[model samples]
Target: MPDFKRGRSFLRGAPAACLILFLAACSGGQPSAPETAAGPTAASTTAAGAPAVPSASGAAPPSSAVPGASSSTRPALSKEAQMETDRLLIRAAKANDPVQVRKLIAAGGDVNAKDDIQDSAFLYAGAEGFNEVLKLTIAAGADVKATNRYGGTALIPASEHGHVETVKILIAAGVPVNHVNNLGWTAMQEAILLNDGGPRQRETVRLLLEAGANPDIRDPQGRTALQNAERLGFTEIAALIRG
Candidate 1:
């Protein structure tokens, strides 16, 4: 079997149904640059710390979850209520605020809410290394395989950052290691092309390779991970890929 499907597991306790957001999932490299805020982020939060939620009464957004109300009498918020909750979720994710993320989820926000640019709270959490926030979104059932505006999976950006841990988390959650983006590059290819080709990125490449990423996959200009690593003087990484 190809390495791409070798590890078919997820972190224990996270729902394996796995809703993916495109991302250690960051797009190119560290998002600390001016364009940093715009591309890639990923996460894998364990639900071990999930706050206890109530039953029917507390399980829904406050707008709809009126205490002591019968089913027919239950006061449901209009669509506006859900929209507001989703907006708050986006803000919390953008700010990397796990507490706010948890609260919003408890209040009935969608884990898969996407912003105007097609960035989702879940995607931002992953791309930004917001571990706790990412987990909360996942526990709330984030679409683990969600796509970004550029038609890339979350794993592409995550690998590019040399975020080995985040990449591991995402892969465990079932993000494909070899998925190609609209730019026609795989996660492995992006790791070399967009990074410093340092130890961090090397480890990321190692992880992806171990997870079954195809090193032979190329970018738009026909450069493979090995070629990118070699041309950029990442001799050690290039050698590793060659083997």
Candidate 2:
């Protein structure tokens, strides 16, 4: 009942002091966690460590967004389109038109495509001594070991025709030198048996011999190349076979 006003003032002052003390404690003792700005999430990053961004359409970016990713595959050709393109290529190759051949090849022509006679561009080019077209086919991935309709490699007919340079190209392209055709004759045998045994034919024989042609490979008549050369009186060719 004594000093009632003084008690009220003291009570008011005590509440203010308590508020100040509480604030001081909160600030001085331990700071509250700071509000941080949001950063890129793991999902927002690309495999290459670049930050991924959404597309204008508000969709996730396509896989092409990644560096070094293939964009898209070329559309496959239809069967009819492929067949027609292959026929055009073969025709251009047979015509020895390098320009057309190159264009056709660039347009996705199959270098190994065969025509009705079972002759591929590669086979015809080699058999006919079309070196320009032959080179084009080889560069376009011609099957060097593919056979013709006669079951002979291009080298067989090439040798029979005395195509010395063509023979060299075929041999260098890894055509089997001693490959015996259905006619049961090696390139060397055909070169001697079919030709006049002239200089080109003799050179063809020499090239075959050097490329490891089997001289002893017999023909249908069971005649070795050496016997054929001698029987045909091809003196230089027989001498080559002797060696």
Model 2, residue 19: displacement in angstroms? 61
Candidate 2 regions with alpha-carbon error over 4 angstroms? 1-75
Q: lDDT at 218 for candidate 1?
A: 79
Per-model CA lDDT versus the true structure: 0.75, 0.85
Winning model by TM-score: 2
Candidate 1, residues 1-243, lDDT tens digits: the string is: 223243344333445333121121224333332224633332222245444455567453574455543353213445788789889989988898888888887777787878889888878777766667777777777788898887887788887777777787788778878888898988888888888989988888888888888998878888788888888999989988987
* TM-score list, all predictions: 0.67, 0.70
Task: Choose the strongest candidate by lDDT.
Answer: 2
Candidate 2: give the clashing pairs. Answer: none
- In angstroms, give how far residue 24 of model 1 lies from its true place: 85
Off by over 4 Å in 1: 1-77
